[model samples]
Target: MDQSLKSPGQSALEDAFHAMFELTRTKPAPTLAERLDRLARLRALIANNESRFEKVISADFGHRCATETAIAETLLVLGEIKHAAKHLKKWMTPQRVPTALQFLPAKNRLIPQPLGVVGIIAPWNYPLQLTLAPAVGAIAAGNRVMIKPSELVPRFSALLKEVISTKFDATEIVVTGIEDDISQAFASLPFDHLIFTGSTRVGRLVAEAAGRNLTPITLELGGKSPAIVDRSADLGEAAERIAYAKLVNAGQTCIAPDYALVPEASVQDFAEKVQASMRRMFGTDPANKDYTSIVSDRHYQRLESLVTDAAAKGARIVQAAKPDDPAWKTKRKFPPTIVIGVTPDMTIMQEEIFGPLLPILGYKDATEPVSYINRHGRPLALYWFGKDNATRDEVLARTVSGGVTVNDCLFHFTQINQPMGGIGASGTGAYHGEWGFNNLSKLKPVFYRSPFNRLADLYPPYGAKISRLEKMLRFMS
Candidate 1:
């Protein structure tokens, strides 16, 4: 907040922001060929640097499964690239709009124009995917990009610098390492558009900073995402899907199932099924080669404390995997845990448990689950496991979240065609495919008229034609 503390680096950052604006404003708009070329270059960059990205993520996390990195990070980024490339032209096309009868002889259309430089602030979890995914959309919209990867993932951040520097011009796309001061300065810059992915606390800061400049922002933030399991749902399948999602990235994902609302009658059965699924997935030894470790010990300790505190408060702590289990004692490893009989006062129920701790709250009926979700601040994602179409529809209609998956979790985010973002407390704005392009571009309305058809009668001040035009407007209305 202090300008006096602003270092030369901060001054350079500001200059960079101004230079980007100048470049976008002064340079001729990119041709379709140039946009296509940029996409190709980005694709090549991701493909060529895939291995390096994986290695960097693995090094940063110290136990990130190579396969997980490839699937979650590499595949996701590549998929976004493919989606953006396939839809870029369609998204960029100026859409013709029907002119009102009142505005006769005029043609109107919505033109999609780039918003110049866009600043993307990415999160530490899934660092490569989150950072590059939005970048794909920003580039497809024909806007320059500046990326600030989280400091927690220093290795991947460094790798991004290398990859982006080699693949893109500084004025086109640039990646910067995380410095608190630099990040603050970067967020405060008057970018044409800014997209941030992080926690709600930081999202507020980013939104405030963007507000100061009257710049538009897309905030992708996380909250206590909940999974609802009804009486009619398949307990086994629901448990398996929930466990799989909860363990993915050791539950560091923004859209991971934070907790669950289960039918009271099926609570015990659901817990057993979840535990069985955990055992099956990790082979009773999650610390083995296949499973992932927590990103840091701090996260592990926080998870441990949450479990400890909940258990102390008379909540039932059900260990899907035991403490003596290989998964438990391993460095940065917290086994899939479930806390039942959880009251609203419990820590597990109150906070966004960004770990593999799934708290199950028993409910009397489907309505209770919907009510519970609605009572809480909307989450980044919501999950429902039910075969009944009516039940699924009911849940979908009743609950609000950034995204939803009918019988699974986190997969909805994979669909680039649909808009992905939070409502209310979860976050704001969406970015993916066409939505992402639109987020980074301004849809300016354009109107054209033929001089030959200009209506002179309506142009006169308070003439008899005005009454006639008013009648016509009333009729149209």
Candidate 2:
């Protein structure tokens, strides 16, 4: 936490607050074309700074793959910008509604209005994408934005501050790099809408702070997202996809499959296949330059502790490869770890294992696995690997989550049309594509009446006319 950075962040936030207020209150609402142009500019800004963003992320995380940054952050942000640009006009247009027969000469419409200043608190996992994605929606909705990138990724945070400061003014868009206290102060600011993406614990604190101002929030929190493997599923493909998804970014993804529920008869077989796939992906040594390392030493220690605690409690630990060199340990490079026979009482099962440790639980039947999933708080994402459409439909219909994928993992979120959000504890509110625009805009209903159809009879004091109006209402109903 640099004092110099903190000071500028505070000043930037205040300037952003005033700027947003002025833009929302005084500036004429931007037309659909204007909104699209703004999004286009954002796209160019991100594309132009892609290399710098990747470099900053790599410096922050120690070994972030540039390709991963492109796919997860840069490309994703660009895609969001393009999606918003394509749909802005239609999303912004006022929708006409049917007027009641009693108000024959009246017309009704639903108009969307921007919610002024929107604050986005993004986590370090996907720093650039998370910050820019929501900001795209806010801008597309004709609102100003202030972004607070996680201090954990200091290099990326600094890079974002530089890029944003150079590209846009504080009134239109701004980014902050600050310490914990400064972060808290930024969260406490009264914004029209706020979006925070992080762990559920921190999300609760953010929600509490935002509640003070009655600010609407879109919380994108992570939980123990599960992957269920049915007896009839293609074990080879499932193992490959699941392994790729879990090991990507060293399993730091919010929507990555945290654990698997495999059939008792196929547990051993699935484990073998998963181990083989892991070897193919990362080879015998995951410490090689090809593999991504844990974000920091603190997170590495946390994962090690979880593994140690689980092992002491009689959980079987299996690693994809053995670490033969001292360099691996010092670099915080953890091999893809799989734990078995884990009980609900274990620490790994109790908390979100946001690392490379994947747990496998054996169930006697599909019903048992489904019951187990339902017993837990709804997750942000659910992955089911099966071929039967009926079985998939049954699970889909019964299971509750923010998003779901059939015969795959973590890909549902890539679709721009489908809404992504969670039920119960995972999170609240959906944002992406049209959903994003809707989240930042207020839909106000308006009714217009013609002088010819001004029903004065119904406006008078209660009398025989009221009875006649009631009769007419009944008829219309």
Candidate 2: tens digits of C-alpha lDDT, residues 1-477? 354666665766676687778778888888887787778778888888889888888878888877888898888889889888877888899998988888987799999999888999999988888888888889988888888889889988887888777777777888866676669888788899999999999999999999998999999998999999988899989988898889888899999999999988887888888988988887766456667778888898888889888899999889855433456666767878888889998899988988888899999977987899889889999999988888888898998899998899988998988887876678899888999989999988998878888478778687988898889889989
- Residue 174 error, candidate 2, Å: 0.7
Q: Lowest-lDDT window of 10 residues in candidate 2?
A: 320-329
Task: Look at candidate 2 and give me any clashing residue pairs.
Answer: 402-421
Top-lDDT candidate index: 2
Candidate 1 lDDT over 1-477, as tens digits, reads: 476777877866777777788999899667667888888898899898888887888788877888888888889888888888887778788999998877768889999988899999999889888888888888888899998889888989988888788877888888765888788788888888889999998999899989999989889999999899877788999999999999888788999999988989889999989988987887556556667778876777788889988999998887756544554656566777888888988878888999888888888866898888888899899998887888889888888788989889999998878998998878888988888888888899998875755366578687787898778779999
Query: What's every prediction's RMSD, in angstroms?
Result: 1.9, 2.6
Q: Give all candidates' CA lDDT scores.
A: 0.84, 0.85
Alpha-carbon runs more than 4 Å astray in model 2: 1-12, 321-325
Model 2 Cα shift for residue 9 (angstroms): 5.0
